[model samples]
Target: MTTTAQPQTGRAEGLASRYSTFMSRHASLMPTFAALAILILLFVGAQIYFGNFITPRNLSALLLDNSYLLILAVGMTFVILTGGIDLSVGSVMAFTGILCARLLSEGFPAIVTIPVMIIGGGAVGLMVGVLVQYFEVQPFIASLAGLFLARGLAFVVSLESIKVEDPIVLWFGSTRFRLGEWYISPTGILALLVVAIAAIVLQWTRFGRTIYAVGGSEQSARLMGLHVARTKIIAYVISGVCAGLAGLALTAYSGAGYPLYGVGTELDAIAAVVIGGTLLTGGRGYVLGSLVGVLVYGAIQTVISFMGAEQSWTRIIIGILLLVFIVVQRVIVARSDRRR
Candidate 1:
């Protein structure tokens, strides 16, 4: 009897150890699940509050309205995973939109204008990365400079909103596919494609692993012979390019470009990233999580709109959620430290 009891106790201890290890390994995923849970709850609440909020038409509208934001969040995820921030993404979006609008107004084809916007945005991102990696500039300051430069450039291009009269641009903005009772926009497809590609790059590629390593610890990453500077810089470039693409999506959605279109957008992206479970300190997060975060954001706005509440409620709710996620992250970091 004593021998049997000892074996059972040992087995229980072994199981407990395995459970702890598993939890430790995947703890970063908690915030993502939390975000997902919040999304579901919000959706349910919206349905309860507004009766028809769960219909296909409303769902499609949510995707269409927030496509640009989803794209921006994907790029922001890459930067945040490296424990860096890109404040310029919002400004880049505005700059790209304004530039593309001007070019289109000048009779440039969509084909030409699109690539130019992407390249230009990438250039700005590269500049920010170079400043941060080579000049020893802080990420915030470097990105802030980028923000100012991009915003200033947008104003320089035009101080007023430029209407996009190009046929292709208008077609993109107005065209929608009927799926039974729901309508889907081309811009929404673009946003989903960006999310899928980002997910693959971050999860499967060598560059993606290097990004995680750098974010984990720059000193350790260098010791492991990773291209820390290149990875970090590329992250910013990806962000910039995404912002540019988002600008195109915005142009398609609105049929015009305003220099102030993406004002405070960077903050929104960061909030989505953090609320999605990406650590502000860097290293452990998923791009899919960012997608869910975007949905949550869109859901809040949808709920507010359906409820006929003032738009300010969206920001207020998001602020409360952001604060909650930040506290959760601190708790996660504390647990990780305790484990180490």
Candidate 2:
């Protein structure tokens, strides 16, 4: 017991220190933890109050319902990290969904239609990125134009909801994977998998680091020789692809594509991101935290419904909460600046 530690143990100790440092720097994660706790409590409360809230059937329903939102949030997290915004995400998703439905209506196989939708979305994103990065346009303004354009495309394609009729594709939306004592919908599992992959990409990759660097300070990032323009452009491309896939998820979930499907989804996604502790100014956030934020948001919606509030109350509460978070962020940023 009195023997000194082995040299190999020093490396382990160092690794632990590094991890602790990372965690401490990201102490804002407390909000996510608190959000998780609240959601768990709400789930239990829902079980008591609603009787049907925590059933396996209900669990599956919640997952299926929110899958596309999770997908859209994944892309939004990337865009927000660069201190930029993508208001067009929801509209873009609507556009792509209509495109997929139209293609399937034309007898295009799912295999062919999927890539076509995604590639088309990517092209839209590429053009937006070029406008923002190469042409030096403000992101908000550029993305606003994109939103209008995508909405116009949706209207031009069809002003009404179109049904999807592919039996094979329908299965993806309606199927469930069963295990002993429980089952989960395919859409739910897909959303979870997408979130996990996004977390890894944002947390461990050079590209991820570059995103943070750009968000933290563009001039400093440029001085560090980061490919800022390329990275920024790629971020939107990823966002666009996510939107397209989200459209597919929405279609599969609902069994149809509606021109009005994603109206205000950007606001919901933005609220989730801000609540997740992502700095509005950029450079500080976590993907896992964003997931927690999403769950928290969903829980709030669920809880409000349980409390018998009108649907309109949900929007009011969301707006108030967003304002509170913005004020808190401003104070924290100010204090941090002073300390620096």
Where is model 1 more than 4 Å wrong at Cα? 1-21
Q: Residue 265, candidate 1: how far off, in angstroms?
A: 0.7
lDDT of 2 at 49: 84
Candidate 1, 1-340: lDDT as tens digits = 9999999999999999998888789999989999999999998887887788899998999889999999999999999989999999999999999999999989899999999999989999999999999999999999999999999999999999999988777776688999798998889888999999998998999999998998889899999999998999999999999999999999989989999999998999999889999999999899999999999999999888877889999999999999999999999999989989
RMSD of each: 3.1, 5.4
Q: What is the model-wide C-alpha lDDT for candidate 1? A: 0.93
Q: What is the lDDT of residue 48 in candidate 1?
A: 85
Q: Which candidate is the best by TM-score?
A: 1
lDDT value for model 2 = 0.81
On lDDT, the candidate that comes out on top is 1
